[model samples]
Target: MLFATEVDAPGVAALERVVLDAERAGYAFVTFPDTPRRPGIEAGVRAAYLARRTTRIGLAPTLHATTTEPFHLATQLASLDHASLGRAGWVVGATTAAEDLATVGRTGAGDGEVADVVEVARRLWDSWEDDAIIRDVATGRFLDPRKVHHVDFEGSGFSVVGPLITPRPPQGQVVVIGSDELTAVLDVALDVALVRATDVAEIATRVAAARAAGAALVFADVPASFDPSLVEGLVDGVHFHGGPPPVITASPHGATLRETLGLPRPLNRFAVTS
Candidate 1:
């Protein structure tokens, strides 16, 4: 099974040290949890910075669907994927805290709205075909406009028009993960589901249910002090948070996050074929 951990360092130096150490220790991926408690760098920006520093581990940053614009959220993640050489994942979040809402001057997003944001982000990622960039110096044309299509997605309270400002990400689409509790309430599919439970049996039950709900991978979210062996056979991976890091086997080296996780790169939905 694979293993992952959350790094909530207070400063950039500490962040780099933890992430690099995690990579050397053989973790598949490292996530940055976004919260008011740690207020300096935004999670996405921190992930982008670490993308250039770490070579093998996947970088996933918690991005809320409610506070950010869909277009910007999609673009930021697409940019992260490019910077990380196809090793980017997004932990989908929808915060309902009154303080968070006040800062954004908005109300909490419903489950349907959150699901729509995820769908729109995915569609925007596919708006540009893989072959869209055709740099022909002789013709002086940088791209084939025909290969780029408009997403034209309308959902919840907003609408997005045409193609994204950026091209498709290296992984075709960055992996999307959500908490099991959130996934159960939303109607969107996730690449990975993070399950939190009290015991091994509950973890197993949640993992099974998450799989049934269309999560390609299911990870048990446990405290860093928890034993990995307890849920060894029950999950595809273990995601640790807070406390000391758990001892685990190393993940395979020199592969993208999707590759390491055995998740296939998705096909561009707007691509044309003969």
Candidate 2:
């Protein structure tokens, strides 16, 4: 069983303390809600800071795809993975309101468009082959250009071309956490399903459907005080909120969320084969 906490309780210092405590208490991951500005730091910036403060705990920050450019989002996530050594996850969603879209110079975005953004991110992540960087000092060759492929992604919401400036992350593809509406799109394309439910039965059903749909892991959004064991067989993990600072423990630490959940590290589909 794995535990999680949302780092948005009191203030920045409190969030830091909660993250450090969660790391100590053997929590699998901590999520930073992506509230634009409501008496809290930005999720990505907050996660970057927390990444430096803690080791072995996954740092997942909610990111809205509609407001942010897909290439920028991909780059940010890839950088976060590097900073966290493969412990980064993207909790992505899209904005539906026209006014909100206007703030970012975008229009006509929906839940389905979020999937396209995620796909673009994935393609960019795979742009550079794992062994693309050779660093052959003798030949003064830093990277093998042939190994880097252009994404050439064209979608209704956005379009992109060429490889990402950053190389593929250590995790290849960072874990993706999405709302239940993304279940169909995320299935076979993403990693984790972060679903909200009002009751245990609802949680069980939703989680089961997500699993059946192709999610490797499913986390039910619940109170931080909720018992992880209650959803033991129902879901893979429990995402909680409103908890005190976690304390240190003796259990083994997982470098990635997959490790924390006993799931095998996924192989990169774009990886070169000998």
Candidate 3:
């Protein structure tokens, strides 16, 4: 089983220290939880900043799908993947809290809104094929326009047209993660599922449901203070709330997050596979 942790440090210095420590301790990834209660640096920006500092460890930042613009969100994440050399992940969040909605001057997102946002982001990532950037100095051409296709995603609340401003990320697509509860309710596909439960029985049930919902990896979200034996063999991995345990045997460093997670690089939808 793999181990992961959350780093919610308030400042860059503190966050860097904790993240480095987690990397040393051998955790697969460190997540930054973004919420109204914990007001601080944006999660994606934090990940981008640390992308230069560390190697091997995956950086996943939480972003609310409900309020954020899908086009910009997709672009930002694609850029992060580039900055991190394909070691980026996104925790798709949906919030209906009064304060959160008020901050964006928007209404609450429906049940499937998070899924819609995820789908649109995936499409945008694929809109630019792998070889879209030809950069042929001889012909004075930077890219092949034919290789970049329009996504034309129309969701319930908003619509995105054509290709993303950013090129396709190094990983083709950044790994997508969501809470087990959220994935359970919506028909969303996730690379990883964070299962939050108080005990083994609950963890098992949630893991089963998350797998049924098409999550490739299922991890239990355990509190900072908890029994390790209760969940060791039950889930694919464990995501600590405050931090990881004191002792962890690090896994072999994989070049990218998807590589570390044993997920294959996705085929570019816009690529011509003749």
Of the candidates shown, which would achieve the greatest lDDT relative to the real structure?
A: 1
lDDT of 3 by residue, 119-233 (tens): 9999999999988899899999999998888888888788899699889999989999889877777777899999887778988998998998889999888887766668878
Off by over 4 Å in 3: 36-38, 243-245, 272-274
- Full ranking by lDDT: 1, 3, 2
lDDT of 3 at 157: 81
Error of 3 at 204 (Å): 0.7
Candidate 2 segments exceeding 4 Å error: 37-40, 184-188, 242-251, 272-274
Error of 1 at 135 (Å): 0.3
For TM-score, the strongest prediction is: 1
Model 1, residue pairs in steric clash? none
Model 2, C-alpha of 188: deviation from truth (Å): 8.3
Which lDDT value does model 2 have at 80? Answer: 92
Off by over 4 Å in 1: 36-38, 272-274
Who is ahead in TM-score, 2 or 3? 3
Please give the RMSD of candidate 1 to the true structure: 1.5
Report, for every candidate in turn, its global Cα lDDT versus the true structure.
0.88, 0.76, 0.86
Worst 10 residues of 3 by lDDT: 242-251
